[model samples]
Target: MEQLVFYSLGLGAVIGALGVVTAKNPILSVLSLLWTFFCLACVYLLIGFEFLAVAQILVYAGAIMVLFLFVIMLLNLGTSEAADFDTARAMGRRLPLVLLVGCTLAALSILAAQQVGGTSDEARADLRSVGSLTDLAQVMFGTYLLAFEAASILLLAGTVAVVMLAKRERRKNAA
Candidate 1:
């Protein structure tokens, strides 16, 4: 059951990512990104990482996506023209390169699947260790402090950049 959930989450994320890439409308792309984040949170839940799952949903879907949508709306991004067929044709020239990369990724995924078989009882037990919010916090602060701090700094910088970019220009009226 857990394996099935994991696979569903993975497929959902992939499809959502494709939707984000292919959707011409900026709003639709942002919505697809929200779906992608939700699926990832679900995957975390399936793995018994409840705190992580909640944090993912709260930080990503709740805060980040809202901020993204607000910025898109504020900037009047809806009026941008869609990509033309000529652009698609140009992009088609890279098909061979994309296929090569896809093949390499598929090979790596196959090898990873072979190496990491179905989860055993011990693996399940380990997942239960940090299932609680308190345990998850302990692990985050103790084991993953550096990664956590880096992410916080990255978020802070992104927020500042967005605010600066969204500022409007002042214009003087001719008498």
Candidate 2:
């Protein structure tokens, strides 16, 4: 069961990564990136890192991706009629990079798996200690309180900046 979940998440990450590179439309790419984050959250879940998984979903998938989509929509990036795919150019640029990144990630995963070996009962116990939402809230509001507050402030600033940027420009007529 664990192996099944690991393989599924690995495949999902690969597909999402490929979609981010190969999708011509920017909106599609953003959606792919969202999938990538979601797959990562799943990977965290498979390892019994429940708090990390929920944070991955809430922070990256919920907050970050929504901000990305909003910025993309606000900028109106893909509306130009002249924008079209240059398949040869895209393939030439992206293929080697993709292969290199994939190889590196595979190597790292293998190395990490070898180091961690199989899950132990001890590890499961430790995971359980920090697994619940209450445990997460305690850590966030206790040890990591300052960092959490800073992140909220940053998000607020970003929201204000986006609103200012989205305001329509006024044109003046010549007298």
Candidate 3:
């Protein structure tokens, strides 16, 4: 039963990821990402990490998704012009490379799963305790507090840089 559930969630995650990749519309891609995040939360729940699951849903599925939608709307990307892409030609050129990469990733994932699956019941108990909300909070606010703040600062700097570059390009085009 557990294996069945795990496979189902895994399949859903894969499908959601494909949707995000294949959808031409950014909004649709974001919605697909939301589906993927929800499936991730479900997987966390199945693994006995209730706090992590709730945090995933609340942070990624709710707040992050809302922010994504807000930014998409603000950008006013109402219509996307079709790219001058030759799908047949591009597919012919890239098919082999894509297939090779996909196969490699699949093999790696199988190997990783095998390695983790070899863990004993005792290790799983430790993982459960280590992954608890209190432990996570301590790590984030105690041990890694400086690192966490630095990451946020870096993200803010990147955002400002992008906005400035966009404004500069807009002004140049207008002039």
Candidate 4:
């Protein structure tokens, strides 16, 4: 049952990712990415990482996707009349980079699996604590509190700057 669910979620994620890359419309691509994120969250849940599952849904599927949709709408990128998009040409151009990245990821996955398999039971038990919300909170608030706060402030400042620049641009265009 668990294996079936895992494979189903994995398939959904792969299909969603393919849709994201192949969809002609920006909105449709973003929606496909959202679906991929949801599938990933389900897989995380299946693997006993409840915190990661929730964070994946809330952060990537919710906040990041909303931001993507907002940018697509703000830029009015729904139409492809002005720009000709040759899917085959684009894929050809990126094929080498994609293959390189896929190979690198495969190597890293094999290495990680080997390391995990060689670890003692005690080490593996300790690693499982990493997925616990209590451990996550402790690490975030206790050890990396300052860094976390700094990142949040930086994100806020960036948001404000973008909004200000956009507003100024709109006003100038209106005038």
Q: Could you tally the backbone clashes for each prediction?
A: 0, 0, 0, 0
> What are the per-residue Cα lDDT tens digits for candidate 3 across 46-108?
988878999999999999999999998998765354243326786689889989999999999
Show the lowest summed lDDT stretch of 10 residues, model 1: 166-175
Model 1's lDDT to the true fold? Answer: 0.83
| Candidate 4 TM-score to native | 0.74
What is the per-residue lDDT of model 1 for residues 50-159, given as tens digits with 9 covering 90 to 100?
88899899999999999999998898875346545237686799789978999999999899766555668676576577576778788789899999999999999999
> What TM-scores do the predictions have?
0.64, 0.66, 0.68, 0.74
lDDT of 2 by residue, 94-126 (tens): 879979988999899899877556778787677
- Report lDDT per candidate: 0.83, 0.82, 0.87, 0.88
Q: Which candidate wins on lDDT?
A: 4
Clashing pairs in 3: none
* Leading candidate by TM-score: 4
lDDT of 2 at 68: 90
Error of 4 at 52 (Å): 1.5
Clashing pairs in 1: none
Give the per-residue Cα lDDT of candidate 3 at 122: 93
* CA shift of 76, model 2, Å: 0.8
RMSD to true structure for each model, in Å = 6.0, 5.3, 5.6, 4.2
